[model samples]
Target: MDPAVLREDMVDGLESATKDVLQDEAVAVAMRDVPRHEFFDDERLAYADREHEVLGTRVLSPRTVARVLQALALEDDDSVLIVGAGVGYTAAVVAELVGATNVHAVDISRPIVIEARQNLERAGYDGVLVDCRDGAQGFPEYAPFDRILLEAAAVEPPRAVLEQLSADGRLVFPRGSQRQRLEAISATGDRTRFEAVSFAPLLVDGEQSGTLERNRMAREDREHAVRRAESRRGWEQDWIEWEHSVSSR
Candidate 1:
């Protein structure tokens, strides 16, 4: 079967009555144009709409990608920053909508970043820049992105990422911890919530795969411990906000 034919079938399924996930005509068209099979060794399964695991990070399903892009509402030439560029599949799809040079991606896992860069190049999108960075911090070198996409869930969307949005820019992310919703926030601070979804929590420094510390809670525990240590009489003040004054420390 030709890859083009497979992509057409994939788009058809996404637009079908049962799925109806790819409602945006531009999103559907861009997705159809991207060579998703190039990102996979087994091209046969590339068109499957289910999530796949790679480098200890979950590759978002096609429906999830559709939802994110729809929420982003990307325009031609819109600069996109992908916070969790796992296999670079979403970035490649975005490159179809926005030029390859306009797509910037970052991942907390170094290996994933390297792999994502390679994957994007293999998918014929070599101009998309993929970097190793904390997803919370975002890719600030190219700050003021027209559109930003966070592929992981967070209880509170990182303020740094929000700050990186261009004036009138939009951010799409899975918000919440145990329960998550597809949320889009504009640079002007208006929020739009979409359907409920589940995604793994975002990773931070020293917590990525193959790192010494598997403790993702270390940052919070450290913050609370510091608060206790700094207390006048150990427990003088309650730890209502675990991240109070964390930046100064």
Candidate 2:
């Protein structure tokens, strides 16, 4: 079967399953147009079931990708930034959805970046700008982005990324621990506010250990304090009940 046909089938399935979640016509078309198998390693192609992480890079599930693209609400005039773009599949899809000239995709891995560029070129997505850079920092050279999509998860929203977004621009990423919800962050004068939805966690490197440690300690402390407070409250309630019973007798 042609990869294009497979892609269209996937899109159709996704649209059917998530009609409310993804209503954008352009996003559906983009999903149909991009051949996802081209982005994966030859070995991984056999398992073309759904999107999964490969080589530390995630090929986002069609449903998830379609949902996020709908959330972005891309416009033909919009300039988009994709962080942690693995092999440019999502970038290619975004470029097709939002015009290739307006898309820029960046990743921290040099090899992956090179592969992405080649894949885009081969797929006739010449308009996309693929580069290697710190996914955490974002691509500032193309500042004032109308939309920013982080392919990976971050401990906290990066200041650099927030700075790159144009006013009213929307950024979608995973936030929170344990329950890492997909958050849509919009830039408002000097600050960014977000709303939580479900999304897959992104992988990133650097200072992760310290951040994890801090979060663990904070969680432990909160649990300890809650336990102690509950213990005290229970003891107080018991004493009150005993005093009332004795006085009544």
Candidate 3:
């Protein structure tokens, strides 16, 4: 299979399907520049009709990749932190969008990290850092990133990741359990806000701490009960306050 042809097809498909969805010329160019076939090991399947699933863990469809790149809104000068950087395919594509010098790809699997390094290098993205670490725990050593993308899904956006974003920085990932929704989180002042959309759930390893899981479930139930109580409080005082503020304005 010719990688060039496969890459062109994927780029052309993205160009046609996402022309309106993704209005960035740089992202379009980056899609065209990066060869997707190089990321897959199956030569015959590289250009096959099926979506490319890396290491049987993470799936990277052309459309999904395009959407992620578009969501990132990467600038040439911006630095990006990519979690769940499987085999560096998404990382390589992202590196193209944000310049190799400004991209760092992190993955938990050591061998996969090595594969990612090779893939990036093979795709002429040698400058991109492909590091091995627990991606759930954002790389604090390089905190305050201009942008962050988690290729895998999480029950909720990791607190560490939210803290790592620079002011106004964007973070995209899937949030939810049985029903995952795509979310775009942005850091504003000392707080982070999120907008929910939809995407496929990312493949992530289960938590190792049983105690943490039990505690998290308990906290979630408590929070849910509190929210229900608060909603039931009937906007009485809050509604009056809001009305007064609106009238004054």
Can you write out model 1's per-residue Cα lDDT over 131-243, one digit (the tens) per residue? 88777788888988999998888766688889999998999998887789999999998999999998888766535553222224446745655555565464543423222
* Clashes per candidate (backbone, < 3 Å): 0, 1, 1
TM-score of 3: 0.72
lDDT for residue 226 in candidate 3, whole number 0-100: 42
Write down the worst ten-residue block by lDDT for model 3: 206-215
TM-scores, each model vs. reference: 0.85, 0.72, 0.72
**Which regions of candidate 2 fall more than 4 Å away from where they truly are?**
17-21, 42-49, 189-249
* Alpha-carbon runs more than 4 Å astray in model 3: 17-23, 47-50, 189-249
Of the two candidates 2 and 3, the one with more favorable lDDT, higher being better, is 2
- Compose the digit string of candidate 3's lDDT tens values, residues 1-249: 467777677566656655444456777677777876677767556544346545544556666676777777787778899887776877877777767878887875666788888888887999998887766678888788999998866677667778999987989786665565566777863323243434434322222211122113334634543454455555543321111121122
> Largest lDDT belongs to which candidate?
1
Best by TM-score: 1
Off by over 4 Å in 1: 210-249
Total clashes in model 2, counting residue pairs 3 or more apart in sequence or in different chains? 1
How displaced is residue 199 in candidate 3, in Å? 7.1
